[model samples]
Target: MRIVIVGTGNVATVLGRLIIAKGHDLVHIVGRTPEHTVPLAKEFNCSWSGFSELHVINADLIIIAISDNALLDSASTFHTNPVPVVHTAGSVSMDVLKNVSSHYGVFYPLQSLRREMMQIPEIPFLIDGNTPEMIALLENFSSTLSPFTEHAGDDQRLRLHAAAVIVSNFTNHLYALGE
Candidate 1:
């Protein structure tokens, strides 16, 4: 499967690595600066491009691994036909890709991912989309990557995200206070 990732950040770099390791093709790794993403693209052996280059590549799935704030804006830069696009965000809704395309979905991995730390790679995947086919495809894609995959709707996902913040973020804050 051809995959295009729209961010060279931790999430994108890690996920793209796994996808490539799984024998899938990573078509491109898009980022704002060539300096930021070019090295990662070389390391992953994928093409590097900026935001405007999104339309130039064709992939079965386009994963937006950019920050939550940049999602909507980054999404607006691409206008692909029927390409299944998914974002890796907990708080953001699937609606962020509202005007981007019909084949958009949410592929949130329910875990705190960081470059310095090695993740378990078996975290629960919160999957949702606009269509049944897209949802199924996401489920299959996720299951291949991890054992835990579930169909979490918008409301459930949002609530889970909030809880994650309290447990992960807020708890971390308390730990910091203790120190």
Candidate 2:
């Protein structure tokens, strides 16, 4: 599958490398700064471009692995051509992609992502898609890396992410305080 990855942050880098290593073609790597994506593009052997250049590429899937706040804004810049687009966001609902494109969904990895390490963690993917076909495709795609694939609606995914924040984020804060 030809994959287009938006954002060259930790999650984007990790996911791009993993998908490339899995023998999938990463067609385009989009980022705000050239410096952020150039190295990743070189590593993945993909074209490096900005968010505006999203429409220029031909890909089977466009995965937006950007920041939580930037997801919607970045998605708005994309010119949708009925291509399957998925955002890697745990807290945000799939509805955010509704206006962006008809073939939109969430491809969230339920784990803390860091790029330095090559080993992608065994994290379940809470997936949601616009159609049955996309849902199945996302489910099968998630299954490639992790065994657990759950079908979650927008509200359900949001609530689950909230709980994760309390358990993972806040708990880590407390642990740091204790230390």
Candidate 3:
């Protein structure tokens, strides 16, 4: 499977690594900056470009691993006609990509990430697609990476994201204070 990762942050880097490690082709890395995008693509031995090239690029799947706030704006940049478009965000709904592609979904990796972290964490994937067939494709794709794949719709994903923030963020803050 050829996957184009469209983000330069922790999620994109980590997931791109996983996909490459799984023997799939990372066709391109599309970030907002050449500095960020080029290096990430190099790590996977693939080509890369800025968000401006999204409409012209082609891939089996386009994964937008950017932050939620940037998602709406980013959606305006891609064309997912012959392929599917999925975002790795819990808080953001799949509708964000509805206008861009008929085949759209969410591929949220339910875990915290850090650029410094080298070890592959146990990532549970919460996936959803606009149609059942698309969802099945996402499910198969996710399961190839993690056995802990689940089908979570927009509402459940949002609630899980909120709880995740409370549990992970709040506890981390408390720990920092305690230390």
Candidate 4:
């Protein structure tokens, strides 16, 4: 599948690498700044563009892996398209992408991801879509990236995100005390 990834952070970089490694075509990398986007695009050997140029790129899937705080405002910039559009956010609702495309969904990765990690960890994706068909399509696509995939609604994802935060924070606190 041909894919376009938005954002230049950990999630975007990690996911983009995974997509390309799986024999998929990474058509473009769109970010807020050229400084970050250009280098990532060079690494992927794909085109790079700012959010303003997003409408021109054609791809099978567009994944918005930006920060949760920027999602609402950034979502409005995406021109409506027929291709599937998804966000890798755990706390946000899938409806945030409704205006971005006719087919929109959530492609939330359940595990923590860091681009600098020496080994890629097993990521279980929690996915949801606007329609049943869209949900199925996201599930199948997610399966190609990870062996674990599940259908999760807005409430479920939000709850899981909260738990993940608590667990992460507590672990950090323990490490700090140990130190």
Task: Return the top candidate by lDDT.
Answer: 4
In candidate 3, what are the lDDT values of residues 1-179, reduced to their tens digit? Answer: 98998899999998988898788889998989888887787888999888877877778899999999899776876776768999998999899998878899999999997766688876899999999999989988887888899899999999998999899999999999999
Models ranked on TM-score: 4, 3, 2, 1
Model 3 stretches with alpha carbons more than 4 Å out: none
For candidate 4, write residues 65-158 as lDDT tens digits: 9999899877988974888899999999999988889999999988788989646777889999999989988988888889999899999999
Give per-candidate clash totals. Answer: 0, 0, 0, 0
- In candidate 1, position 159 carries an lDDT of 94
For model 1, how does the per-residue alpha-carbon lDDT over 1-179 read when each residue is reduced to its tens digit? Answer: 89998887888877877787677898889898988899988988878888887776788998989989888566777776678888988888898786777888899878777655444366688999889999988988887787888899888998998898789988899999999
Candidate 3 vs 4: which has more lDDT: 4
Q: What is the C-alpha lDDT of each candidate?
A: 0.83, 0.83, 0.88, 0.90
Instruction: Flag the better candidate by TM-score, 2 or 4.
Output: 4
Cα error, candidate 1, residue 101 (Å)? 2.0
Model 1 Cα shift for residue 156 (angstroms): 1.1
Considering TM-score, which of the candidate structures 1 and 4 is the better prediction for this target?
A: 4
TM-score per candidate, chains pooled? 0.92, 0.92, 0.96, 0.97
- lDDT by residue (tens digit), candidate 2, 13-75: 888877877778888899999888898889888788987777777888889999889986666
Question: lDDT (0-100) at residue 110 of candidate 3?
Answer: 90
Point to the candidate with the largest TM-score.
4
